[model samples]
Target: MQEFREILVAITNAHTSKAELAQAITLAADNQAELTFVSIVQPAWFENPLLSRDDFQSFWDEHLLAIAQPAMDAGITVTTRQICGHPFHEVIRLVETEGYDLVVKLAEPSGVFNRRQLTGNDLNLLRRCPCPVWMMQDKDAEQPAQAPVILVALDTSTDTPEQIALNRKLLASADHLALQEKASLHVLHVWDLYGEDRLQGPFINMSREQVNELLKETESTNRDRINTLVTTNGIGDAAQCHLVRGRASHEIQKLAASLKTDLIIMGTAGRTGLAAFVVGNTAENVFAGVDCSILAIKPDGKKHQAVSNETDANK
Candidate 1:
């Protein structure tokens, strides 16, 4: 299992939850990793006449100290920094320059409805960060008092080398987290018969029985792939494996809810060209629908070099 050597925690606002901070501290201590508390200071903070620059600086110093003291006490190396720039850009800059392997932040809710949603900053980090980004949702006050559950979503339909490696990374991450939290691990793969509609089209000469047989074959193949992944990861009997046939995003949300998943560990593929502006559609949809925390990992060799270059050019 891959352990995080350096962890960066982004403090987005004054309302950042203590629960989330404690979670980060626990992770750093468990992994024996160095922890850094970072906050982006907007120009408006200094522009306000009610609060002087010195007063603001003093307040932030105290705030960060209070947040970091616990980790320090736990014998984990800790540091704090306040950078003045765009929140998303500065956070990614630190991750790239400092070689932090994991970025943890509390997901901020947006939109008029104020649903449990990932804000624009969270989405940007998930899309472009060089390493894994863990976005934690505020714990529900009435959540059930049961052992924590972690659901890992895997794409088992592809046999490409890159996809295979990504699947392994996801499984490893979830397994490591489950062990750390003493949580139950659940692996899910959502599969469907592709081009089924076209197969049933009027132009195609296909009988209902024939289509049913094809669907069965597709499901079997998916099951075999998922089982292989589970066994290879040494989680065959330890983790509950789920194979559901439906839309990927919908099925993930459904299973996570049913399992009362505390965290979801999944992959976020970073594309090139214009598509790079958005995360994978399935990931974005899952982010919107589920209230559970998400830990998104990118494929190997997909670094933030492109994003960094773009930022430099713009500057």
Candidate 2:
């Protein structure tokens, strides 16, 4: 398991996101980890013009203190602070400054501007944050407390060692979180036999039977890889497995919705050149409309310069 001794949970005061606080607190207590909650506020009355110093400070303390008290009560070392700047910037700054291993924050609740149901800040952090970001779902508020179903999306197609290492870490995270919540685990690998359709033709070409055989072989190879991974990693067979032929983003979303999955644990395969909040990349496409919570894990210490430039342009 990855070491997550120092954790940062962002408490947004725009609305009541108590579920996120509860999640962060439970994780910190169970893991015996240190917790820090930061509520980003307006710089000052004279500076931001949008919010007064007194009002901003009041909301900040009330919001963060509510989360801090519970963590302290649970016997976890807790620290609360109020910072100034945009939500994404402050959180990223804290993660960089304090060396937090994981970032926990509530998914931006739905509103008119939030047609995708996720804030631009959410996408930015998931893209550029140097640590893993857990976007807790607001959907939990609509249902009774229960063990959530966690779906882990695996990309076994990538043959690089770095990609393989990241995939292993992603599965380890999925296993750990599912075990912690006593939730059902779902492992999925999406594959497409590229050029198979184009290869079919007249007299001297491939037939439907040949295509089927190729697909079967590809499926078998993927299934074996998954079996080896789970067995060697101590993951039990009770978890559901899916090897589907479809696009990664669409297939994962369809399965998560059908199963009413509570959280989808995934690794961001995006590199520094990927665009943000778009359908081209897996994480960005998933963030667009998936209702469930998502934990987008990045390879350790990799930065997305594309996202950074976009963020700077926005500022």
By lDDT, the best candidate is 1
Q: What stretches of model 1 exceed 4 Å from their correct place?
A: 139-144, 305-315
Task: Write down the TM-score for model 1.
Answer: 0.92
- Per-prediction TM-score: 0.92, 0.86
Put down candidate 1 lDDT per residue, 145-203, tens digits, no spaces. 89999999999888889999999999999998999988999999999988888887889
What is the C-alpha lDDT profile of model 2 across 216-279, one tens digit per residue? Answer: 8888888888776677678878578888888899999999998888889888844555454453
Candidate 1 — worst ten consecutive residues by lDDT sum? 306-315
**For model 2, where is the 10-residue window of minimal lDDT?**
306-315
Reference-based TM-score, model 2: 0.86
Each prediction's Cα lDDT score? 0.82, 0.76
Clashes of each: 0, 0
lDDT of 2 at 225: 80
